[model samples]
Target: MSTEVKDGLRISVLSSGSTGNVTYIESPHERLLIDAGLSGKRIEKLMGDIDRSLTDVNALLVTHEHTDHRKAVGILARRYEQLDVYANQGTWDAMAPRIGKVDLAQKHLFAPDTVQTFGDIDVESFSVSHDAAEPQFYAIHYEGKTFVILTDTGYVSEHVEGVIKNADAYLLECNHDVEMLRMGDYSWPLKQRILGDKGHLSNEEGADVLMDVLGNRTKRIYLGHRSLHNNMQSLCHLTVASMMENQDFGVGHDFELLDTQPEQATPLVTL
Candidate 1:
């Protein structure tokens, strides 16, 4: 096998929840960000946690048009005059019209099923089922391996299952436990969305998603986008761990599970 030292990929999560969300991706040729759902101050703190600054980013990549995904979009773009933004037409249309202006000069349109690059990091975008316009997930490629990120969706659709199945790493949604979500104190309508096919994936559902994809090459799994009101981190970790244990493969021997902190930065996923 060839070494990937010349073009390694690193993913760092700043925050990931209703409270906020952001992720930093570092490659040899580019420094990029996935989302900016946090306030400027919070994102700054997160950058500090990673021992980097917002200035390190060459551009920002948006997943969808939701606020939790766009919490600091315009602010950061404006703050850093040279920072470019990449998104699908729907997402850009949904967000770009808001400020009645554009700051970043390089706003590229992302089409589904397209393969492109941000420096040495290869990126692929695919459609996802969510309430927002043209919601999507990302699959990043580098060094003969792929890392797929699937979150903020009601469920893992068959389409997504295909894209994520053979990934070496995944930042997947393990939002809540079915029982806790149903019996907890959320409004009826809100609860329905969380459970719907277009809603977030519960711990059990997330496990099912993983089961379909748990091959030998799955090196890292970080269960993300957990709900603070209805879910506990330990439950998600334990539930996924137990389910993986039942599988035929020696799940824990090579694969490691990390939970994204709703209030803090997760350790970088390196490959």
Candidate 2:
């Protein structure tokens, strides 16, 4: 049966941070969750806050095996019986024990660079530099519009740039401010790990990535996966905004810049 088409593409970040991460995306006919890091109950509540429900979710996409990214994958799939869970084989293997008791039929494994279609939306995965066994980001395409998902990467690579460039909307990471992170209470090793190439993106790096990928076609950018202890929402927004202004890109005129909160769901963004 054909799924009904809605207005266009809609995205809602249910939660974003080192604590837990989840995003909801819908393309008229299909609805899916990208990384159910939050518990199933939390995800449901967040969706309900946005006037959506778990009952409509057709699938779940796992970005990596990290608890903050895959914590509720299995529970959400099992609760919603019809939900299929997609992940790379490496991610699946690493996360399987944690997720627990997922039906074989619900598992949909794909290698990096694989493209899968669900109704009108086409989902593609690409590798990201992260500490996880295997971590990746996604690009969602629908009706000629592209919405890219990028977070938890220590740095953006050439391939990642290619995948995200000139997109209509971007959910990108601005995880922390280097100075804040360095001076914060985290241990030296923890600090180094976060500063490493396999760690999270710094605010500066996020700005650089935005500069690389954003173009005339870019409409909106959501700064996500911020570090609660080391980063402030205002800081992430202003840092990126300042960079854009310095480059002659008007914050409100060139594109919209917004930050996703770790504890609350962002309003539905239509693209």
Candidate 3:
């Protein structure tokens, strides 16, 4: 299959949830994986299904030290001799032992506040509220277009809103339905952790953040990292769409709305 990227930018969510999380982002000159939570073999298979190749990936950028987000980091880096795995110093220090031994040359560290250039794509990492060592979301700029990945965040701070405002597209988290989570079977401590300041975003909270950042320039929004039990795809879509509609924004016309599943790759999106 041809690996050529069309138009401005191409994005695909390889998987997104508690089980595993990875997102593919590419510019004309470079390809990147946002996270490598699944086994390396599985991630490669997912990429193959979308007519892309893991061999073509230039780097892997990790969000934090969570096992579900860095499960295959070491394996992939070892397999792909030239691949560099990027993360903050804290995340690297916290996740290194868990991911096993990666080649010394393959570990690349970036400060949260600085912009790192990868070929024609420029990546900027920003702080997020999560229980990891130092979790962050990323914004990519290429060909004058912006694509932001904002998931695994407990709450969107004012600074985060400003960083992602008016982006061309977004992969935002819609982690759970608060009511469902509250009444569900999870242990009280687990429930509290999921709802706390360092936990995931609920449908309502996700909608509010989108409402604050989305603008005319916004073209597509993918709801990501949905809980298997606490959130349903249809429910997440409905809740966020309704919120947008109430704010006088036409869901389909103003911007495309989609959801990412933990076991499937999303349709390749080009912008």
Candidate 4:
């Protein structure tokens, strides 16, 4: 058997979109799943396809209680037995009923703005504006590298931007095209919710945040949590790229830009 020593952090977007959202992060000392949105079997298959094992996951960090983000949280926790699930108390309480039973020992609570170390990786939860009890965006630190998993929030507060500034990589959301969302068949209330302060970020909004924070250390940016119904991957990519270019940020030179799909896993990005 060929032996390869795995070091540093490896990240992959298992799936991302309105249907479901999940991300796999493998630090040198711990394996983490940002959200267990898809069915347990589907998550397992995705992990397997990426040459990783679901049963080896060390933790499941749920951002919020939304069905699209917590569908398999409980099932995976039960099946794995060893997986430690982390979420804020508000999220745990709101999601517990829908996710089914998770042992008291297995459930862990993390407060916003607190940095908790699991093995060699340090995970910090930062408050985010979302229509949930308490949603958070994660900034993961390992071996001097930082990777931010940012999505599902309508806007990023100045404090959050300061905290996540100059990360090595980012899985940021570019959810929808505002025009498509406005002109689509969805009801007015739903469209309003998406465009509101507590809804998903549009391409313009997400790009604005990236333009402000990306720096010398920033390397890879994976645009995620896109709206399958209202956003085309090509359009989302072009929009973000065009905006960044306007600010003198050249794609593939300043940083590598990639899109995460709802049904497929992004290529494993190792930092």
Candidate 5:
């Protein structure tokens, strides 16, 4: 409800959908961008909307090499003097050719399934089920507060569920409605890909995963990466909220159920 950004960990979803995806996070000593999917100019404007300076970003973390997630990886790295780009060896190998040329010094690598500290933030990466060179889900820790980013994955793994418990906040994917996708305008092969194990998570699947990981400390739950064609924002939110209600968890009381847009940034929330 408050527009001012307070003390703990602060975050905003700049945009989240099939078109493009980006998230901005700030710790006491560092400012990080989880993905640089949008254009550099667009990203700058979105950060300005939240009163954050994109030029002050210290690092850019790439989740996978998809166009919607890594489109601006090289652009932002080139534009910001202090920004360093980080990805795993496999992701780097798959994305290097697509993101254009980044300076050698600005390129960094971190192993998956390990916790690495950058400035004041500690980022722990885990493998997820997706069709990429190496996809990751991050749990970032700062001053006792945790912010987890879980999107672009087809399914949540047991190991991921174990590591992501008791997070202060999350930007989870509620990508589509299964019935809608099955009857949408996409071709047979495209529809199959979306429904496959390596594709995106549907609304029901996302709810199923949340039921396993929701905890008392989870205050903000953002339903992100919804399909513009196959899923409506109201439907996606209601689907998850209803499922949680059955488990005795009340939306807006136990935790806030937030919505993200493809064209604008969500409210900047501090946990």
Candidate 6:
């Protein structure tokens, strides 16, 4: 018998939410990050929880140019002086303010369906629905296994659905419960955007996505990108639990939440 993963493939939620966002995925030969939204120091500490350092990241994959998702990307890249940023051109232009004056050679741009490698990990980006210039989620093939990360989007589209359907592990967005968002104190315009076709996913929508995507192959689940005012951790937890359990999606065997609060440091899961 052999381990499902032989080359040490793993992922850690570096940080997530409106404040900052970051997640690290690594393999014996491939080292990468999904987003770099936190400050340099904050991101370093988050990675330290999983015994990794900024220098260990081979590349940074940008989903969009939002402040919470790009704030630390340039700093992380510049400090390590080696991180290759992977994103579309529009997102790059939108991110110019944060990336500072990066060297031209360090930028790595790829269109949808294109795949690239970091050491041995094969990363493929697919378009996601959002208001940003062009946001994307990634599916990584490594050590003979596949994992997809879906986050920071207004809604899930056909392309995002296809990629996630076959994933082994998913770190997905479970932003807010509808009632909470509608009744919460957020301003009208902001609330409208949050509920728009290109806004973040609500708890019900997140659960619906799970109902459609979670299959026998999914090993673990991490609900993430929750809004503080628009969602309660308990509500988010119960909603997902009910959805999976009601659907009989291998209850308790593969379900969890990725905390988005600034103060949480949960144990890193290697799948």
lDDT tens per residue, model 2, 1-271: 3334359999999999989999999987899899998888998899888888888789899999999999888888788789999999899989988888999999998679879999889999999999998898899999889999999988999988988899999999999998999889999999999999999998989999999889899989999999988899898898999987898886898789988887699988789
Better of 3 and 5 by lDDT: 3
What stretches of model 6 exceed 4 Å from their correct place? Answer: 1-6, 254-263
Q: For candidate 5, lDDT tens digit of each residue in 1-271?
A: 1234356788899999988999998876788899888898999899989888877788999999999899999988888878998999999999989988899999999779999898888999998888899998789998988888998788888889999987888889999999999889999898888788888999899888888887899989899899998899999999999988888886889889899999699877778
* Candidate 4 residue lDDT tens string, 138-248: 999998899999899999989989999999999898999999999999999999999999999999899999999988999899998999888999999999999999888
lDDT of 5 at 223: 92
Q: What is the lDDT of residue 178 in candidate 4?
A: 97
TM-score of 5: 0.96
Task: Give the CA lDDT, 0 to 100, for residue 156 in model 5.
Answer: 85
TM-scores, all models, native as reference: 0.92, 0.97, 0.97, 0.97, 0.96, 0.92
Two-way TM-score contest, 2 vs 4, winner = 4
Off by over 4 Å in 2: 1-5
Q: Could you give me the TM-score of model 3 versus the true structure?
A: 0.97
Count clashing residue pairs in model 5.
0
Error of 3 at 69 (Å): 0.8
Ten residues in sequence with the least summed lDDT for candidate 2: 1-10
lDDT of 3 by residue, 1-271 (tens): 4487776788899999888999998887899999999999999999998899888899999999898899999999989987899999999999978888899888899889779999999999999999889998799999888999998878899999999999999999999999999999999999999999999999999999999999999999999999999999999999999998999986999889988889799988787
Local distance difference test values of all predictions, in order: 0.80, 0.89, 0.91, 0.90, 0.88, 0.77
lDDT of candidate 1 over 192-239, digit per residue (tens): 988887788888788889889767778888888898987899998898
Better of 2 and 5 by TM-score: 2
Cα miss at 65, model 2 (Å)?
A: 0.7
Model 2 alpha-carbon miss at residue 166, Å: 0.5
User: Comparing candidate 3 with candidate 6, which one achieves the higher lDDT?
Assistant: 3
